[model samples]
Target: MSNINDKIRQIAKETEPELIHIRRELHQYPELGIDLPKTHEIISRELHKIPGLKIREHAAGGYGLIAELKGKKEHGKNVLLRADIDALPLEEKMESTYKSRHDGRMHACGHDGHATWLIGAAKILAQLTDEFGGCIRFAFQPGEEVGLGADTMIEEDKVLEDPKMDMAFAAHGWPSVESGKIGIVRRYAFGCVGDFKVRIIGKKGHASWPEQTIDPIAAANEIYQHIPAILTRTISGTEPKIMSVTYMQAGDVNVRNIIPQDCVFGGTMRAVKREVLEKMKTELEKEIKGICQVYGTSYQADIRIHGGSVKNAPELLNGVKKSVADVLGKENVYIIEEDNLGGENFAEYSCRVPAVYMFIGIKPEEKEAIPGLHSPEYQFDDTVLAGAAAAFANIAIHGCMGELKEN
Candidate 1:
């Protein structure tokens, strides 16, 4: 075990230059959503440089690459390490040499860093094939930002079809924690995401004639006012849940003298448990309809199940906690007791096998960390790359070694 850790550290040190270049290249050319053609091309080219990698591309949606490193002993477990390869639709705000060249799009979530780490791991694993057994699959996924990439990868049967993946692991770059630290939340890591679009229909009339019109704006206001109460009553305090109205569109702006005939509202709901989320949805719908009925108006709500909550496997998490502590030190690792409402595509892999989702610290030392992920100012410290790569390699080797019993 000591020898493996030392080797991982050495490999990370040796690959630092390449990793930097890969991240910068990815940073300069950012692609949005599932259509990552240029990004896929770069990944394909790099992985092909390795000796024994089997790669495949998805016919629809985006590209998914599978690189297999065959083992010598054949007694070890088959494991997988995945990294998402999509960028967000936000203009780059930093003044760095590797800023995004694409307009209105950037790799704000540190996915470029994630992809670089996985590639670095693959290179190391390929070089040290004699020490490990079974196979390690590298999944370069697409569309994580829009919340459909993992499902697309799964529907294509990319990971499940591979006989080598007995378990899987992945990580995300976290901006709140300082560089060289790691955060591991074992129980409930992230919340399920649900999107709702509501439409209210009412009769239009002159503003002066209040009795002649059933005002949709008034009904929407009522529905909005009742949301806080609904959340408080329907969702328990022990469970983490939040509902917010993000977008609203009403009648044309030019006609202030006339009441609008209809109004549209859209928002999201997040929770740690699926059943609880469903209950909240039902209650919200019923309440909205009832309120509309009272106001003599009709309403429609469209709720879409976007992403499921991230539930880390207990055993995998234990392994991760130990591995991260081993590399980053025990004091730097924090185990969060509660679930976060943020959605991650990594949850899709958790459904198939034992998986661990972790956050690698990228907070700057001087200024307060950039705003949370997806914000315009969000940026990760490149120095965290060494710790992140080492931690990921440690988790991969430990997971494939099958030393820890399932919890």
Candidate 2:
């Protein structure tokens, strides 16, 4: 490894205590959505200690923070390193020292670690500004769970403008990948996220008198059953997609004798690309319309695709892989071929710029299987922070200096 890479690894490891402390503090007081006041304060307090960083506070409505670290040399290119600071609306079930104190709010998605890694990278990169070139934008985003933070920052605040980022990189915690390893996906890393709702409207009447009213429940059930069939038939079997009906509802349970005026069902839709989402939505709407027509009920359907797939720039993959290899090892790094339907908001940046989205492993040895990301029991050991920090810092430094190869 090069001297700078060695230095980065050493410093990142040495700062493990600091990283854990910050992560714990943030984890204890987890916040949700865009308005994260306490989360902002904690992050800002630590970032203020760094000298070269010029912090852009609350670029979005809430704590959509961006800290710019301009290098001393004018020889290289502008690069961006991003992280998220939002937590999910789930009560943490883990009985750890750093368990979330807030009710119904927790960093179950490992975003606390994500934020810590970026903060660690910022600290390390700030110390080595003379060793690099161009500028590094450390975007600490909020509302990543809602898939709106990056979009708002990029579109409204222009976080990537001014110097105009040449390359961008972001990483997420992957419990299935095991600590000390890194996973990379070429082209599309994950799929686009979309939410759809279907409402079946009908006249209300007593349940005993079926002929007196049009039943919306029957129409909703028919539409729900046809949804999965539509997906299976619309997209090819080779590139599978996901459509989960998270919720379905009708009249009050207290009054079972009365037929409800309306019934509603909604769920998430995911695909490797927007084309798949569009195809599924088109079929779903058609199915709903036909089913409602048959049941003599009117229907309303709303389907919106939130963002594009998290795509990696082919030009930057080699550079990123090399950076990870330097921090961990070539053996510890991998190029993942499969595409996941999981929604990641980092797509907001990658879809617009040359960005690489990575998944850092945190699977513990004690457990037979890793806890899912949004699970209440989700947690990662503190060991993975240093490696992630080292890799991120190295990527930012070398990438800015043009030491990293570009296709």
Candidate 3:
């Protein structure tokens, strides 16, 4: 391993106590969406303690904070490190000293850990600026759940400007991999995401006369049944795509006897590429249109595109992977074979610059079932904090100083 990475690992270990304190505090008082007032305050307070960090508050026109640290040497390449600080709408289900105090907010997606390790990396890199020759911008953003935080930071706050970020990077906590390890994706790691709502319109009538009503429930049931085949039967077999109807309903529970005037159903669609996702969405509406026509009902389709996939720079993978392997042993760095359908706002950064997003494992070796992201029971492994911090710092060190060298 490189000597610079060794020092980063050491500093990260020494900074664990502070990392845990900040993580716990942020986890306890979780806030949601772009307007994270308390989250902003806690992150800003800890970042201000680090020397050489020029803190930029309200980077997203909300509570987003970006901390920039420059090297003592001549300017080289500019790198951006990002962490989403928003929480989910779920209530914390796990018991701990740092469980969320807020009733309806939770850090179920592990952004608290992301923020902590980023801060820890800042503290570590601040000490070793003499080894590198560029500026590192630590972007602590909000509203990742709504998929607007990264856009606001880039377009509104000009996060990619000022220094003109040459490369960007971030990591996600994934339970699919073992704890104390890391996972690197060679290509696209996340798929394009789109949400949709379909409202089946019909006429209401008494239960005694089935022919008198348009029967929206019947049309809705048919639409629900056709959802899975919308992508499988329509899109090409070569293209990886999926459509899942997460929710559907119609009529009041109090009056079950009368037929409802209309029924509504909604779900999400994903594809390996953005064009494929759009095709799936269009096919879905076409399928719904045909199904509703057969049932003698009109329908409304409301589809909202979230964002694009996370595309890792093909040329930069080996270099960043080597940097991560330097911090954590090479044996601990695993390659992810498949891309996930989950959405991420970080694609906003990947679209404009050379970017790579890795995954830090949080799966426990014990017998209990592992919780997935966005679940109320999801727990982030604190043991990965030091390694994650070291990995982030090492990426910056090697990327700016040793970028041209072969791994």
List all candidate RMSDs to the true structure. 1.7, 1.7, 1.6
Tens digits of per-residue lDDT, candidate 1, 80-100, equal 888988889999888899889
Residue 120, model 2: lDDT of 93
Question: How well is each residue in 1-407 modelled by candidate 2, as lDDT tens digits?
Answer: 48887789888978999999999999998888898999899999989988889998877777878999988886878888999989989988879877888999999988889999999999898888889778899999999887668888988889889989888899999978878899998767889888898889999999999999999999998888887688777778776588889999999989989999999999999888898888888888889888888999998889888878987888888888988898788998999988877888888788777888899999876666878899998886688998899999988887887767574
Query: Model 3, residue 81: what's the lDDT?
Result: 94
Per-candidate Cα lDDT values, in order, are 0.80, 0.87, 0.87
TM-score of 3: 0.96
Angstrom error at residue 342, model 2 = 1.3
Kindly give the number of clashing pairs for every candidate.
0, 0, 0
Global CA lDDT computed for model 2 = 0.87
